[model samples]
Target: MNRRTYLYAISFAIFAGRFVHGAEPSSIRVLVWDEQQREQRQAYGDQFLGEAIASHLASLPGIVVKTATLTSPDHGLSDATLDATDVVVWWFVERVVSRVQQGRLALVTLHSAHWSKPFVRLMQERAKSDALQQIPEAERATARIEYLNDQPYGKVPKADAPLAPALTRTATGWSLVLPGCIFPAYRPDGALGHLTTLLVDHPIAKDLPKQWDIPQTEMYNEPFHVPTPDAVVFEERWDKGEHFRSGCVWKVGKGTVFYFRPGHETYPVFKQREPLRVIENAARWLGGEVRKNAP
Candidate 1:
């Protein structure tokens, strides 16, 4: 495993040490908000906002994770799923949020969830053409090669459209657009709070040192323009706005919502460390003590 990967494994072992001693484990039911971006289905896609978390939690006994999305019945968060869901991680910008504020459904938002280019690519591509032929053999092969090489949307300085060619080249692998176009790594506003980052004991960041592949990894590094006080739970010293908001836990009638503002389609934290910890904790927190569900 890579350095970041090894760190998380170590951190998980460290964190688990506590659970092994004093904590009584409870089952966590997690739901990620995934929307099918029909077009970008090529470049990069899916709505499993908390996938990294889901994977980690799934390994823990008692935790049950199910996926729900915007494309599913009732946007994938059906009544049954919602009722059973201890935590729901949402990141779709276009998704119509039900702020009904039920005592259930802990909602964790990632990347502030204000962008959904994968969704945009579908509308734009489909609105323009469907008689589309398969990607040219040369470009298709190259894009696939790029993806396999782990170079999809390589390093970009700044952007309104950073992922264009860097991504267009591999977009096909993500099944986004044909080849040649790039995806924007971050929007204008996204560059705001990203000028610096501080790391600490925040649960979400507890494993970052071990999970993030800094020099070799690709993160949107969007700057948080309107950062709120204490809203930042952890920060990256090198990257300006890379902050981890410890954890957001809210109580519902008998359920809960843990809206996390991490994860971005840009870097795709689907297999990152910090995100995994956030998810594991959120699942358990939302899932609550076993007694909460007892007779």
Candidate 2:
């Protein structure tokens, strides 16, 4: 064969190899959880959840999530289940899983924390302390409205507080929040870290809200212990709860977890722009790709 012909063939061969060796795309095994509580479902909206989330993630390429709720056998996260789970979006857990089991999980808490997990009440209480109380009155006003809106769920022993009058309008089943103050936390770090300092110009926070300026939603505030935060990606102000205040994930061991705090909007999580992006960003983050470009 002629030298030029051979060279051309070799170049073509190299291009083919490059195409073959390109990333196969990371696989994500997500376990969508639910505790099957009437109150929880009532709050989160059941009709549109599964397909909406599944289709959204599926469109991202190379990500797959298998859903299971609180009522599923073993809540659908069996030893076999864990073998595939890359990120677990915990819908709600009414009971605590063993530490060994918990270790395997990278959790995301949705809405009012539909299920009771360890330190739940404590987490809520801490978020409502003097620290969170100091947020602007407008923020407090919003939370009060959400609490009032949610009160129709059920009646628990009243805390007898400032937000009480709003509850008078509360209906019945079980409104998730109590008096609906800022979300309490078991925040070990204790404040919102500057996203600029924490993220170091990561893409994940590339398009994040400068101050989470979204409106008409609940607030998630600080006093959180983000495990190994290289960056503070998000801080939810005026959110109804604390879990979403510290929504992030750093490397724990070999695997990664994206701990999302929002998702309280009923029916579909995506209906809300903030929750949708958070969920999408989280899924992409776990995949080791550029969803945020959010430094």
Candidate 3:
């Protein structure tokens, strides 16, 4: 071949290799892990809760989804599995968020996941962040964390009871305190919950109603003891007037963490159209899979 033609052929081959190897379209990978506790049958019926969620995500374009259970080998969280997943729907436990802190993936923490280790660690970091800003640098080393809630888990305080609020300042530095995760009370007989959009402009709230009702769900009163969220997108309220900040988000490291508070394994909350939409929307937003111009 002529010299120019030989050069052109080499360049074309190089370009083809780059296109084939480096330009593969990336698909968002989702792992839904449910404890698959029998209680979930009350709401999910035959399908496990995690399976139900995974089934919904699989239907979306460009999403590659899988479901794992506590029964799975390595509890469904082997290094290989987590390394391949982009977003995790956790129904129990906490180690996954450490991966999130490292910017490997974003986390969508669900209801009652408030007690999850990742959520607690995030709040602790947030509390320390808040306290550090308020105190002098000289006191940084001696800052103390005092546990405020002395009671056992699931103990609900009276509505009028005093809450051990967050970020209490002290003479040396500051006191990092948080109230109990559970409210003072809950009515298991069930009540109709009204969810009001608190931040309508947020991507997670896209296509949602101004207000929607959960026909029958248990109640959780407020004073939800976590660090102040970066945004509260939805607030849930019961007919009796008890209320909770049901949807909260925080930016952690290079990704975001979202806590959605509607599911109660025994309740069919996830089966509802709106709640399912919320989960799907949240997954897309957190995974950076949403297209800028797509409606």
Best by the lDDT measure: 3
Error of 1 at 127 (Å): 39
lDDT of 2 by residue, 194-245 (tens): 2221353555555556544333333344433222233456655432334343
- Tell me each candidate's RMSD, in Å, in order: 17.0, 19.0, 13.9
lDDT of 1 by residue, 1-295 (tens): 1222111111110001112222235434444444433422222355233344455666777765555444567765454544445433333222213321222233344443322222222223322222123456454434442222122223233435323212233334533322221223433222322212243454444444533332222333433211122335443322443433323333322333333443333444445454566556544543453234333
TM per candidate comes to: 0.44, 0.47, 0.79
Instruction: Please tell me which model should have the higher lDDT, number 2 or number 3.
Output: 3
Error of 3 at 195 (Å): 0.7
lDDT scores of the candidates, listed in order: 0.35, 0.37, 0.62
Error of 1 at 131 (Å): 54
Task: Supply every candidate's count of residue pairs whose N, Cα or C atoms clash at under 3 angstroms.
Answer: 53, 38, 2
- Which 10-residue window of candidate 1 scores lowest in summed lDDT? 9-18
Candidate 1 Cα errors over 4 Å, as ranges: 1-25, 38-56, 89-103, 112-231, 237-262, 289-295
Superposed model 3: Cα runs more than 4 Å off: 1-24, 89-95, 137-165, 169-172, 178-180, 289-295
Worst 10 residues of 3 by lDDT: 9-18
lDDT of 1 at 173: 53
